[model samples]
Target: MSAVQGLIPQPSGLDREDDVLTAEGLTKTFGTRTVVDGLSLRVGAGEILGFLGPNGAGKSTAIAMLTGILPPDRGAVTIDGLPLGGRTARTAKSRIGVVPQEIALYPSLTARQNLRFFAGVQGLRGAARAERVDWALEVTGLTDRAADTVSSYSGGMQRRLNIAAGLLHRPKLVFLDEPTVGVDAQSRGLIFETVLRLRRELGMSVVYTSHYMPEVEQLCDRIVIIDRGRLLAEGTRDELVAPLGDGLLRWELPAGAPEAVRRELAAHGRVESEDTPGGTALVITAHDLARALRAVTDLAVRHRLPLTGLRLDRPDLESLFLHLTGRAIRDGS
Candidate 1:
């Protein structure tokens, strides 16, 4: 019998050789609670996997297990074809870089000083260390401030440097755990550009975990969503949200539109749900907002009510999340 035929099906085998990482039935528990439960995932070379979930949905715990910071209570994991166990995972971790959600740089250390320290830890020295530090500074656009302490840098600058630090050794895989949080728009754009450049130029496998739906829509080739410690869904953004393509267009009927006003409006579009304090938010499947707007306005005029808000909302990640979980994407409960 084949090795995988006897054991659990390996997620990595879905791809050809050069699969960067895989997790099969990974589970982690604390006390009576299981943080990560039987989660299986795979990322091939040059693939960017976007991982997203509600808060406390085992995103961090699963990442910890995958990267060797925490042990799985059951199942198996591998990085760069090496089993994630014993000292093997530690050695494998050395070849992979992690940009954690929290900044790992020393506040008192200059950018160059911080890079040098990390270079030493990664077994880089002499000319290679200096070259890497210089290259990182240049790429992160911190060449002018390489001598300044991290405490002196702006939040965006610090984040850029944080990414540069992750790239010093050019690991085969990089996991970014919400690296864009708290960054300004410009910084966010820069980080996005830098991440894309890495995938385009160096063919690195990036596993990005974030709740920011738009970023995932823009950057990821495939997105795997987990909720309640289990895989909820996986596919391209279109594949996952395709059902929503036939979704509703929302509008707010100006205040004081009597209960009967909804009935009149129903002739044009379906009313999915409404909030009284905020006016009526009617939903119509696959309908154009412009036409809905005309109908809503005509009804409001007939009823002598005010016109409130109008929106054309497609079924994006947020809607898909709500569809699957019965609540907002940000709402864990």
Candidate 2:
């Protein structure tokens, strides 16, 4: 199968007034099991949106429905205000490119050959097909090795070729599913550059999904997190992390904290009791670290509580993920 499968090519102009893609109340069920339940999101033109979910979060199922590869039991997908299925589906798909998690290429074929094959799949013909093939090679930095067979290329080169295969027609929106997996740092960095270029140079929108937290934090304009097939959160990094508080202040009390001390600290922040090897500790989450620390110290001194140990933690995406889903973003659920 082709690495990236898409429909008829259309004009490259993007509609800036409306979102590039929007899925409303998407639901999918297989027999008695439901993998995706009312999942919905939007992608703006020239924006890179990060889609994050733990394993078995129905992300793949949602993507299939959004791409028109699978039918949704309930819900609708619109691309540039056109419904994603039925008569307008072809036009809607023309704006999309997909770089799948797996490397999609025929090992025996040369890089150029692989691109030509996929370009044909995208309905390019004659001079247009040849031009697009060259453009894809140049964009992916594979022109120098275009004639080399896929099996002879390094892992990074193959990944770049796989990406190039999906983008032959200069799609307006691309869905990149873990494009950097198993790639070297150089290739990964190159992939980042390519994604950024697609947006800067072509005004393309991107939906990026990866288990790597740093990649999503570094690239996406907004982030959407889902778990158990349900939408849990969506927003910019600061927006999502804000509600979790600014930082965590942990204080180990040589003797268990008194109820009055806990109550006094609660006025400053949310306090939780944690069992530690040394003893019980009070972990407080607050927006202002300096004020929270001073409050803790004052209360401890007033209540005659001895502090055995102390630690502080800043809030970040990983902490937000754990706070919401309680599961680290792993490959398998």
Candidate 3:
């Protein structure tokens, strides 16, 4: 039998539960600083959970605790009803596959050779090993180039191969940390397709972390936002953003925009000004874009101030992140 046939358990028979992985009050500390402070979240079976946080928000620390790489100072992690640590730690670890942010392959080796090495570590041998290597190559769309050196593969191919290595044992849950980072558009799309396949075809739960807001917006069924090691919000995109009310209307004005104009814009809603490459931008939170646009245009015309540009940005994950953390996700990164 092929390695995928032997190693990959039939997902059709597996129980699909709402909570496949749960972390309750997970805390971690380093010397004097508590990195991950009382974190908690849940991932549903066959669901893509977007794990979001600013850099240094203890995301890495929290992930380490959940993956069994590091024990939490307080709190607990349960995977597939198996608690982490003690007799069940190994079993719990077995249920998870982690695709780290870094490339874990040896550039000198062929893609097939890398798979063989990882599969061997997982205890597959002989024909089983060969079958799994082939399966991984095929699933990652690298079968034709399986013989090629890792050094020759594009950034995206290398990333897909990284994911394939993680799936050798067919774990029920996967942790994908910035899987699409540093890859081209085509590679990003391919990675997305591969992840979707894991959920749709194999019924695997995924916890995906990324700085690219749109990727999470597109791929995740639900999102969990964290900052300073605390859970800020968790829900579908609409649920979290809807409470923040309507979107933002931004007006780009010349550097010396009149103070009167700024004060006038604030009367419509919460107005924030920042220096941009183009000019000074006034971002106004508005319930009605049409009225806000008319008001701004009228004010600009009355003041005879040059209006450089106007843009209406609908509420999105990025906006939600900003609303919750008071910082742009990218800026935090």
- Best by TM-score, which number? 2
Q: Report the C-alpha lDDT of model 1 over 1-333, residue by residue, as the tens digit.
A: 211112212233444567888888989899999988999988889999998888778888998888888889998888888887876867788768899878899999999999999988888999999999998888767899999999999899899899888989988899998888898999888888888877898898999987788999999998887877887777788877664544545566655557776676566544555564755565554445456667767876777765546656666887666545555657757
**Please, what's the RMSD in Å of model 2?**
7.9
Candidate maximizing lDDT: 3
Q: Model 1, poorest ten-residue lDDT window?
A: 1-10
lDDT of 2 by residue, 264-301 (tens): 87877777776678667877777687888998888878
- Structure candidate 1, residue pairs in collision: 254-306
RMSD of each: 7.1, 7.9, 9.1
RMSD of 3: 9.1
Q: What is each predicted model's overall lDDT from 0 to 1?
A: 0.78, 0.83, 0.84
Task: Output the lDDT of residue 143, model 2.
Answer: 94
What TM-score does each of the candidates earn?
Answer: 0.78, 0.83, 0.82
lDDT of 3 by residue, 278-306 (tens): 56888787767677888988988897866
Q: Which residue pairs clash within candidate 2?
A: none
